[model samples]
Target: MKEEKKPYFPMFVDLSEKNVVVVGAGTIAKRRIRSLIEFTNHLSVIAPEVNNELLELETAGKIEIRRKNYDREDLYDADLVIAATNDHQLNNDIYSFCKCMGILVNVCSDKNKCDFYFPGLARHENVVVGVTASGSDHKKARAVVEKIRTIL
Candidate 1:
């Protein structure tokens, strides 16, 4: 017998005043952070080093960057968080802590540990479309998003 997994509900949240914290500013983190900054002003990224785009956003005062290794205390005030570190154990730790704190968290590498999945977004003048494959097929999801982007 096969038990069906529950699907994630898609919802648009208001992050304008929410404190969103991202641990690790590598490729995955950078991608998600860029999207998040579009919806929220209270965005923070914690990592030992970040890429040029992230640095530019910080310089523009659009986001706050903590250029240091991630610490548990860094998430103490987070309303939502994204664990995008290269270290699996660290991502797990962040997931566990967010679970305990009742904070929403997305674990980039491990879908099972994620409280929410970051969808592929396609936005136009005033319309936005979010696409996901329930963590089963990222390429397909991105392709669908691209199609939607062109349509929009």
Candidate 2:
């Protein structure tokens, strides 16, 4: 039997006034962006093209939008990053870059390559509940988070 190489330690982070970049504008990326935008207005989206929702957010001046491919230089001052692009190789590259730079990163494609797992969270009043299945079962984590929402 093989042992699990990575162990997930869950914790909350303060994203306020932080430079956070989401490297995709697709469904998954948009979902993550929504959560991030609530925390920080200093959000940036990098992609070749963006969806209507993301564009609308950009138009509203909620975030900084870069309609182009990811550049390695983008990671320079990034405090936190989410690699949610469709290209597996690019996402992995972003993960590696973040790893080398000692930046906190979440690779939505490959959890093993991720420095952190973005947990399913529910914010209620002043309390926030986050749940993770160690990337083993995301559905379960979301389901639990949903339950927490109702109880709060």
Candidate 3:
């Protein structure tokens, strides 16, 4: 007999004051950084180079930007890590390191390597509806989110 897989649902996580690290400063990394800012003030971005948006945020002191390549030491003291680099191998390595450190990690390139999956969401007042396909289909999740958007 096959064991049943548990279903995971969207949760309202409190990230205020939590230390979150984003590994990259490209377009994808920038997007994740933007979302994280809404949740936590203690956020850091690590990258050899940063785009204009990240530079602006760094200059404003909204986030601490480490203008350097990813280092194992960078993972220290981080509650959450986001692997948003375009290099798939680097992203995988970051995920593996986070796993060993028992830190929660999200890999933008592949969902299978991620410890947590972020879904497309729709918000209404305090209510938030998140849609995910459990790594099977992002398009389907997007479609569900669109439907939810129409309803809410």
Best by lDDT: 1
Minimum summed lDDT over a 10-residue window in model 2 is located at 4-13
Worst ten-residue run, lDDT, model 3? 4-13
Q: Report per-prediction Cα RMSD to one decimal.
A: 1.4, 2.1, 2.4
Which lDDT tens digits does candidate 1 get at residues 5-123? 86668999899999999999888888898899889989999998888898899999999999899889999999999999999999999999999999999999987787787889999
* lDDT for residue 72 in candidate 2, whole number 0-100: 96
TM per candidate: 0.92, 0.87, 0.82
Candidate No. with top TM-score: 1
Residue 36 error, candidate 1, Å: 1.0
Q: Hey, what RMSD does candidate 1 come out at?
A: 1.4
Error of 1 at 138 (Å): 2.4
lDDT (10s digit) by residue, model 2, range 1-152 = 99856647777778788999999988999989988887886999999888788888989989898878899998898999999988999998998899899998988877667666667878976687778887687788888998999998
Q: Superpose all Cα atoms of candidate 3 onto the true structure and report the RMSD in Å to 1 decimal.
A: 2.4
Clashing pairs in 2: none
Which regions of candidate 2 deviate over 4 angstroms?
1-7
